[model samples]
Target chain A: MQLKILYFGMIAEITKCSHEILAVETKCNSNQLETVLKKKYQQLQSISFKLVINQNIATKTIFLHPDHEVALLPPFAGG
Target chain B: MHKKKTVFIEGAITPDFIANSIAKHQTKKSIGAHNIFLGQVRADEIEGKTVQAIEYSAYEYMAELQFHTIRENAFEKFDLTCMHIYHSMGVVKTGEVCLFVFVSAPHRKIVFEAIEYIVEMIKKEVPIFGKEVFEDETHQWKMNTV
Candidate 1:
């Protein structure tokens, strides 16, 4: 499956792009996606971020689909 | 259905804009108290480099959704007459207001609590990012501390 991954804040800085499309296994979960991303961008392993799937934070190992909007969000600094 | 509120401003939130918002509320006769929280960009010295401004960005779609959720939750938890939230996008210089949260209620206590709750949630939940630009133009991403 092809997933659209969004990068924000410091995560974007490391990724060098705001978003991209990555091809992964059809049955991959959030944790597996994170591992794939870390392998692709080794610097990502050093920062803390959360995986947001379809506008909600993915707190557990949720399965990913092609249509799901996936995002990597660094720590929030809003007020 | 509740209409989505506009939360992102292009630059610093001017005092005039804030005054106008308060002025527009004059006809809300039932409101007995109004509490506001303004977040100002600070010129903090980080490793000898002074912050000159903050360039903010966000996952705008997600941010609007989070703001809407916070607003709905606030209305559910407090007896608020109305509330407004505005945060700066792009660049906001040091000493400028970056965030403005206004909450009004029939009584004073509810407004106070509501304002705090709304501000806290915005800080923790919104996917807004701040890049602190230093005097030399170097930047560092800011993270909210507990």
Candidate 2:
């Protein structure tokens, strides 16, 4: 499965890309994806962020799907 | 149930634009009360420097999804006739509007509650970020603890 991931705010600065497509197994969940990303980019391990799957914020157990728009987002500061 | 909304992840929301939006809603005879919440960029002295603007960013897709969900939830929880929410994306200068939430209902009570709920949800659930820019161009990220 090819998942498109978006990085926002400071996360984008750290990741150095706004969005990217990664090929992973269809059975991979949010946690698995996070682990894979952390292994690739070690700085991700120190930041607090949320995983949004298909435009919705999801828990670590949320399953991945092909073409899902996933975002690695940091905490909100909007008033 | 209201018409599809206008959602923008822009630089700053202007006062004239907001006034125009309010004027456009004048035809709604059923709405008696409207409550609006405007979030402004504050100039504060932090670390011996003054803040100039806020560079805003968001998880665009997820922010829209959360905003839609917040809209639906507000309609379910309150008797609102209409609602509007807009937030800034890039550099919003100090004293400029960054976020605006407007809600209308037949009475004052529901409008008040709906607007508050909408703003709260946007603050807590949406994946928006603010980077505070100083006069010297140095920046510090804003973190919301709650």
Candidate 3:
């Protein structure tokens, strides 16, 4: 499956791009994807972020789909 | 169902805009009280670097959805007559307003409580990010502390 991932804030700085398409295996959960991302971008391991799957915070394991919109969000700093 | 509002502004929220918003509410006779919260960018000295401004960005799609959810929940939780929220995008200099939240209610107490609740939820739930730009053009990401 191919996932469209969005990067925001400091995560975007580290990833060097705002959005990208990554190919992943079917049934790959968020944690597995996190590992894959951390390996790809070593700086990601040092920062705290959350994975959003289809606009919802992925607090638990969520299976990835090709059509799902994934986002990497750092800690919020809104008023 | 409440209509979705455009909450993102391209730059700092000016006093004129806020005044206009309040003026437009004059026709709302049922609203007895209006409480507002304005978030200003603070020039904080961090490790000898002074913050001059904040460049804000967000996952806009998710942010709009989150704001909508917060608005809906506030309506369900409080007896609010109306509510409005606006946040800055791009650059907002220090001492300028970055966020404006206004809530109107038939009573004074409800507006006060609802304003605080809505602002707090926006701080915690919204996925907006701020990049603190320093005097020398250096920058750092800002995180909200609970």
| Lowest lDDT block of 10, candidate 1 chain B | B1-10
Clashing pairs in 1: none
Rate residue B117 of model 1 by lDDT.
Answer: 91
Give the best candidate by DockQ. 3
| Model 1 ranges with Cα > 4 A deviation | none
lDDT of each: 0.94, 0.85, 0.95
For lDDT, candidate 1 versus 2, the one ahead is 1
- What are the runs in model 3 whose C-alpha is more than 4 Å off? none
lDDT tens digits, residue span A2-75, model 3: 89999999999999999999988899999999999999999989999999999999989988888889999999
Q: What's the CA error at residue B43 for candidate 2, in Å?
A: 1.8
- TM accuracy, model 2: 0.88
User: On residues B99-124, what C-alpha lDDT tens digit does candidate 1 reach at each position?
Assistant: 99999988998887898899999999
Model 1 CA lDDT for position B74: 94
Candidate 3 residue lDDT tens string, B6-115: 99999999999999999999999999999999999999999999999999999999999999999999999999999999999999999999999999988999898898
The candidate, 2 or 3, that scores higher on TM-score is 3
The TM-score of predicted model 1 comes to 0.98
